[model samples]
Target: MYIHSTDVNRTLQSAISNLIGMYYNSTAAKPGIDYPEIPEWPHGYVPIPLHTVIRKTDFVRLLTFVLNAYELKKKNVAGKLMFPC
Candidate 1:
């Protein structure tokens, strides 16, 4: 099965968003963790900061590459698979 780069990017974005939501919700539900409170905007309007926007894309790319490499290792346990540098 082949996956396009755009599709992978979209999936990664969704996965990151879901993970963040889960983490935040879990923290809110737990009392022992001492999670910091997130400040609320007026009328539930939250703005994306410029720094987060810049760093998130790079973070997503790094995470996706690492996951792909891990999958490759799991599939090629015989050590016969060669990846181009």
Candidate 2:
């Protein structure tokens, strides 16, 4: 599966928020250390499960693509700034 990290993170965040909301609504209890009090606001980094590990080749490819895209965007922005229309 060729999944982007940003997309995966977003989906995970949404699922976690939904699950937390469901748990709180069903039990009518405040969240503890296991869960954040505000599901919408992130407290820290979310840990990825071991089952959903990414391949080394895939990770390298993704990193290369991201870096190249960032560089291209930076150059484009700089060019536009240097030569305004």
Candidate 3:
């Protein structure tokens, strides 16, 4: 499902938390040895595609672009980043 929300911390958190609650008992939420099962991430949580505002529609669109050194070269390119620094 294409999960959407307003591009902001509050809305994003609400969407994520809701998805977690919705799929908490499902296998999709179950951690795997290579995927969400790694020690770096939380157990029982799977990565779901959470889309926000569409590009060219709002200022948040700019912030949504993935930001990294290579992405900073191509344009910062990961969800883990917030700014281009």
Candidate 4:
């Protein structure tokens, strides 16, 4: 499967988690079963490659962020950004 994300670290990690959930094969998790023999590899762990464009070239994402910041500034809301767990 092909996986792609924004160059941002959070997006990269989120893509990796999705790949693990979607593609890992438990039946072939053992050494010499589906890949090179590596004792250290975790069971059912598949190395999935993530593709991303450089930040400067990721125009769509950059534009969205810039627009959001501009809107926030226009609103003039004085508050720290927050997320609830």
Candidate 5:
């Protein structure tokens, strides 16, 4: 998978805001955090999971897990093709 780390901060802020909105109120007052509006996708919606096991509560960590899984799958495919003796 093509993972882009661009705008990691902005993306993280947006994700937190959306989570807060979904859990609490749209205009909920969450101190010690910046609540920015999430970017809209042009086509079909991309879903974000509400619950996470990793308690970092940020986008980069979550995205890293997803990207790593994709990379691992790609590597596995390459390994299988090369060792098909």
Candidate 6:
């Protein structure tokens, strides 16, 4: 899935926007947990930037999901979604 910077940025922004809007009508301006340079992270925590989080394999997986989402013959498989061949 080799996602570029723009796609990653868009995804992050959209996810953050949705999360922020979940319980409040107002939005706050702040950097998210995606920023990994911050010190004193939570215990047993290892932070990675959002752009790096979604790797090539993840992109491929997401592509499969996207394709599967539109598959007419798709069926539930152990609570998992699959694409039709």
TM-score of 3: 0.50
Give the 10-residue window scoring lowest on summed lDDT in candidate 4: 76-85
TM-score of each: 0.31, 0.26, 0.50, 0.62, 0.25, 0.30
Per-model C-alpha lDDT, please?
Answer: 0.49, 0.50, 0.65, 0.75, 0.49, 0.46
Give the poorly placed runs of model 3, Cα more than 4 Å off. Answer: 26-34, 54-85
Candidate 5 lDDT tens digits, 29-67: 333343433455212233344333334565767677778
Candidate 2 per-residue C-alpha lDDT over 1-85 given as tens digits, one digit per residue, 9 for 90 to 100: 2323333566557755655454444343335543466768454323333223354545655777778777776788546543222
Tens digits of per-residue lDDT, candidate 3, 1-85, equal 8887877798899989998887665454545642455667766666679987655675555455533344556553546555444
For candidate 6, report its TM-score: 0.30
Report the candidate with higher lDDT, 3 versus 4: 4
Measured over all alpha carbons after superposition, the RMSD of each candidate to the real structure, in angstroms, is 11.6, 10.7, 14.2, 6.8, 12.4, 12.2
lDDT of 6: 0.46
> Mind giving the per-residue lDDT tens digits that candidate 6 earns over 1-85?
1323334666667655554455232123223443333455433232223343445466655776678676644456464654544
1-85: candidate 1 lDDT, tens digit per residue: 2222323556557655654554444423533234333444223222222222344456656677778988898898798998542
Error of 2 at 80 (Å): 33
When summed lDDT is taken over every stretch of 10 residues in candidate 6, the lowest stretch is 23-32
lDDT of 4: 0.75
Error of 3 at 59 (Å): 13
Where is model 2 more than 4 Å wrong at Cα?
1-7, 25-51, 55-85
Clashing pairs in 6: none
